[model samples]
Structure formats: structure tokens, C-alpha cells
Target: MRLHILGICGTFMGGVAALARELGDVVEGSDANVYPPMSTQLEALGISLKQDYRAEHLQPAPDLVVVGNAMVRGNPAVEYMLDRQLRYISGPQWLGEKLLADREVLAVAGTHGKTTTTSLLAHLLESAGLAPGFLVGGVPGNFGVSARLGQGRHFVIEADEYDTAFFDKRSKFVHYRPRIAILNNLEYDHADIFPDVAAIQRQFHHLVRTVPGNGRLIVNAHDAYLAEVLAMGCWTPVETFGIGQGDWRATLVEADGSVFTVHRGDELIGEVSWPLLGNHSVMNALAALAAAVAAGADPRVLLPAFATFESVKRRMEVVGEIGGVRVYDDFAHHPTAIAATLAGLRAKVGKARILVALEPRSNSMRLGAHAQALAPSLADADAVIFLHRPELPWDARHVTDALNGRGTTAASVDALIASLRDQAQAGDHVVFMSNGGFEGAPRRFVDALRP
Candidate 1:
């Protein structure tokens, strides 16, 4: 089959392209924004890529077009495809109907932690000799690739709650009928499509309804929003996980979340001493462990896998460290995620100065939905340089003013990197936070700091 994908550079859509190519199909794609590591990964697969969605790129009309959620009706390729009456399907729908029909799907869903949790779960199942097929939003350091068709029955996926496509308004996860689902945590996000927290919760409930009675639900005990989702109605047997409470629990062995001991309802499973940091990381560990056991792996056997677990790329990835200064590239745009990541880093660095270079790249951030909470979330940072581009609709002054002299605004990525270089000194941790590529600012700053 010959397939042309719209918006194929996105992490999720790119994974779909990879899977299609691996299935022996001729794959080609176009996108407005093309940056690494997704772009680099696609090129390595020998798949043809176009810079933007031009009508000509769809020439001769492929056998099928996989439409990404990012593609709207007004896009040139979309308009051309519709005018020609070409056969098309949303990415999620195609994935659900094609590859996932026969696999034992183990899906990880939430507002945050989906990528990391999914990667970890696949790693655990792989270590247990399951050799599970998997698709992650970001490349897992353990596997070096985002999606693969493995030789085992289990297929682990990072199930996102975003809309499927311009034509399909329902959340994407509803199409994935997983036997094992993890409700890691829930919060109000994606301000572009969702009106409020209640609206988002309704979509989560739809996903819950799809799980069979024989399947298992691994939920977060601390999130009331998720509890409400379950309360709406649950048919599957549910197991909860938290730091101190739940069917599965963890006791912190170190303050930075790097070391922890696992417990499964009064029986000590084992200790986890890994490189991850933050209480959120511990919560992710517990959730993955429970889901792995539900998939028939022994809990005790999976403990050692945690110690050797290599996390997903760009989730606190260290790009460079030079002249006693460490630079990190992190994908944290939401307020809750930003706070959790900073808190973990603070615990790890002790009293070292933590400087943040932030870009409000997500739709929620650009629309000013999270502006009020931004200041308080950055409480862990000693100073912050916020990128306030001219095209952004919202003013960032409200957030900067709330920082009380700790925050300032930058007009561009170059200016932001320059500001950080002048302010940073020896023994400081510099973090660049954004969901998008931020024009490669993180590495640019590292280069500027070089001798």
C-alpha cells in the first residue's frame, strides 16, 4: 500500500509513519514544522518527506491518506484530497483498525507522564522476555526507535487524549480498546479543544467504558479528577498506586526520587535505585510496575529492570555540561508538569542555582490558559527567562511580574540564550523547557557557553 500522511513530523504521527513503513508500505509525508529527533528518525527510515502540505505533494493520489489531528480543513493537502474524493482516515482510526486488532494492548493514558510511563512499561515487558511491540510519543533510550512490531502478543502504546482529527472530534484514546490501561493522572489541558476540566473528564470516561470487565485499570489514587472518571462507571477491576497509599505503594529511599522501595499490598517486592528524579518519577514507576504485573509478568522479576531503565528522550535530557555548568533539555509546558520537573531537579541539586529558559509553546500556554499558575510553578527556579515572541497572542508580563524580580522576558530564542549565558555561572543547572523544538535553543546556549 502507498500512504501519504499529513502532519507526519509530530511525534505521534511520525510513529505511525514508522509502523507503516515497517509493514512494507510505501510511506510519504508533509508537515509545516520539521525538526529533530522525529524528523531525523523518519529520514533514516528511507521515507519521503515534504516540507509543507502542498497540493502537489498528493500528486497521483496515494492509495490512502492518513490525516493527523494537526491537519485542518483549510490545509492545501486536505482540500486537495477532499476535492479529489480520495479515500482517507484519521491516524488513530487507522492504527486501531489495522495493527492493534490482534495484539494485547497495554495503553498508558493521562495528561502527563504518558510517554515516560509507556516507555517504562514496554521496557519491563521486554525484560520479562515478553518482547512486546510498542509505540511511544518520544524515542525510548532503551530501544532507540519509537515504534516496532515485536514478536510477542503485548503491544504497549502511549495513548493520548487529544482529538483524533479535524473530522473526528472524539479523543484519540477511545479507539484504542486496551486490555490493560493506566490512568496515570488527569488535569485540564489542551485549551484549544477542551472548554474545561469537566469536558476533558468526559472523554476519559469514554475511554474507561471501552475496557472489558476482564481487563484491569491502574489508576492514580491521589488524583481526584481520575477518581471522578472511575466513579462515572467502571466495569473492569481497578488497582490504584501512590507514594503512601493504594494497592501498590512506594517508600522513598532517597529525597530526589532516584532511590525507592516498592510494595504490593503489604508484601515488599524490592528496591528501585535508578537515575530518574522527582516524586512524579516514583509515581510513574509504581504505575508501570502494576500494569506489568497485570500483563502476567512477575512483579519481583521486574524490579531489577527499573534499575537499568533508560528513560525516554527529551524528558529531562542533558544536552551538555561544561565549565561546571549543566544544561538540560526538558519537555515540560504545562504548569503541573513544570512544577513537578523543577521540584525533582531541586531535590537532586541541593542548593545549586537552577535557571530556567522557558518557551510557552503549547496551545494552552500560548492562549494564556496557564499564565496565572506559571509563576508559582517556577518557584523552584532561582531565575527564569521567558520567550515572548511578537506573534504570541497573550502578554507574558502577568507571569513575569508575579515572579517578584526572579523572571524576565526575552524577545527571541537568541536573546533568551544570550541572557542565560550572561547570568549563568559555575555550579549552576540550566534547563530549557518547551514542548516544541524552541529553534534548538538548548544546544545553542550550550555552544555559546563553550571556550
Candidate 2:
């Protein structure tokens, strides 16, 4: 089968393209901005990629078009597909019909930590010799690739809550129908598609409704929004995990937040000593462990794998160090994510100066929906810098004003880099936070910091 994917450079779409190729299909794809690691990974897989979406790019007429969620009505390829009445399907729908339909799908869903938790679960399964297939949003350092077609009965996926396609308003996870679903946590995000938290909750409820009565739903016990979602309806047996509560819980064993002791109710399961920093990571570990156990892996044996679990890329990833100054990259755009990333870094570095560079690139941030919460989220950072882009809907001046001298705003990437070079001292840890590449500012800062 010849499949042409639109907006295929995105993490999820790129993974789909790779999986299609792995499944013995000839794959070609087009996207507006084709940069990598995703582009590089696709090339490594021998997949052909075209730069921007053009109607002519579809001249060969693929047997099927896999549309990405990023694509909309105005995309030339989408319009061409519609005009020609060509057969097309959303990426998630394609994966559901082709890959997930027959497998025991272990899906990780939440506004945050989906990628990390999914990768961790996949790794645990692999450690248990399950060799499960997986499609994660970010590249797990352990896996090397973001997507794989393993020969196991289980398929682990980073189930996103984003809308499937322009034609499909339902969340992407709705198509998954996971046998083992992990609702990591619930929070307001993606302001572009969702009107508010309640609207997002409705979509999550849709996901909960799909789980089979025999399957398991692993959730965060402390999240009130998740409670509300479950109240809407849940047919599956549920297992909860939190810091000090839930059927599964993690007790912090170390002050630096690196070591944790896992417990099943009052019974001690085991301890996990890893370099992972923050309570969020601990919760992610707990969630992953619960889902793995639900998938039939013995909890007692899988606990030690957590110690060797490498984190996903761009989640507090230390890119390089120069002049004793460390530069890190994180895919944190929302207030909650930002807070977690910084708090984790704080726990790891202690009293060291932590400088945060943020680009409000996500749709919610661009619209200034979480503007009021932005400043407080960066409270842990010793100094905060906002990369201001005029093309976005909201003004960065408002964010700077909210910081009240605690933060500074930069109109361009160069300005931001210069500010960091001047303000960042030898003992400082500078973290670049954005969903997008932030105009390559993170790598640029690492290079600039070199002697």
C-alpha cells in the first residue's frame, strides 16, 4: 500500500509514517515545516518527505492519505484530497484500524506526562521480554526511535487528547479504545481547540467510556478533574496512584527526589532509585508501573527497571555544559508543565541559580489564556526570560508586567540569547521551555555558552 501523509513531520504523524513503512507500506509525506529529529528519523527509515503541502504533491495519488491533526481546511493537500474524493483518514483512525484494533492497547493520556509515561511503560514491557509495539510522541533515550512495531501482543501509545482531524472533533484517544488506559492527570490546556476545562473533560470522558469492561483504567488519585471525568462514567476496574495515597503509591526515599519506594496499598512493592527529578516524574513512574501491572506484568519484578529508565528527550534534557553552565531543553508550554519542570530542576540542583527561557508558542499561550498563571509558574526560577514573538495573538508585555521585575521579555531569539549570556553565571542552570524549537534558541544558547 502507498500511503501519503499530510503534516507528517509532527511527532505523532511522523511515528505513524514510520509504522506504516514498518508494516510494509510505501510511505511518502508532506509538511509545512520539515525539520528534525523527526525529519532525520523519517529519512533514516527511508521515507520520502516533501517540504510544504502543495496540491501538486499529491499527483501520484497515493492509495490512502493519512491526515494529521495539525492539518485543517486551508491545507492544499487536504483541499485536493476532498476535491478528488480520495479516500482519507485521520492518523489516529488509521493507527486504530491498522495497528491498535487487534492489540491489547496500553494508552497513556493526560494534558501532561503522556509521552514520558508511555515511553516508561513501553520500556518496562520490553524489560519484561514483552517487546511491545509502541508509538510515543517523544523519543525515549532508551528506545532510540519514537515508534516501533514490536512482536508483542501489547501496543503502547502516547494517547493525546487533541482533536483527531478537522472532520473529527473528538479527541484522538477516543479512536484508541485502549484495554489498559492511564489517565496520568487532568489539567486545562490546548486552548485553541478546547473552550474550557469542562469541554476537555467531556472528551476525556469519551475516552473513559471506550475502555472495555474487562480492561483497567489507571488514574491519578489526587486529580479532582479526573474524579469528575470518572464520575461521568467508567466501566473498567480502576487503579489509582499518587504521592502518599492510592492503591499504588510512591514514597520519596531521598531528599533530592531521585529515590522512591513503591507501595501497593500498605504492602511494600519495591524501591526505584533513578536520576529522575521532581514529584511529577515519581507520579509518572507510579502510573507507568500500574499500567504495566494491569497489562499482566508482575509488579514485583518490574520495579527495578525504573532505576535504569532513561527519560524522554526534551523533558529536562541536558544538552551540553560550558564554563560550568548547563543548558537544558524541556517541552513545557502550559503553566502546570512549566511549574513541574522547574520544580524538578530545583530539586535536582538545590540552591543553584536556575534561569528559565520561555516561548509562549502553544495555541493557549499565544492567545494569552493562561497569562495570569504564567508568572507564578516561574516563581521557582531565579530569573525568567520570555521570548516574545509578534506573530502570536497575545503580547509578551503583559507577561513581563505580571512578573513585576522578576522576569524579562525578549522580542527576538537573539535578544534572548544575549540576555542569557550576560545574566547566566557559571553555577547557573538555564532551561529553555517551549513546545516548538523556540527558533533553535536552546541549541544556540549551548553553542554561545562555549568558550
Pairs that clash in candidate 2? none
lDDT of 2 at 33: 89
Q: Could you give candidate 2's per-residue lDDT for residues 218-332 as a string of tens digits? A: 9999999999999998899999999999999888988656998989988999888887888988999999999998888999889788878899999989998999999999998
Q: TM-score of model 2 relative to the true fold?
A: 0.98
Error of 1 at 322 (Å): 1.3
Each model's TM-score? 0.99, 0.98
CA deviation > 4 Å runs, candidate 1: none
Predictions in order: lDDT: 0.95, 0.91
Per-residue C-alpha lDDT of model 1 across residues 1-451, encoded as one tens digit per residue = 9999999999999999999999899999999988788889999999889999999999988999999999988899999999999999999998899899999999999999999999999999999999999999999999999999889999999999999999999999988899999999999999999999999999999999999999999999999999999999999999999999999999999999999988889999999999999999999999999999999999999999988899988899999998999999999999999999999999999999999999999999999999999999999999999999999898898999999999999999989988999999999999999999999999999999999
Best by lDDT: 1
| Candidate 1 structure, TM-score to reference | 0.99
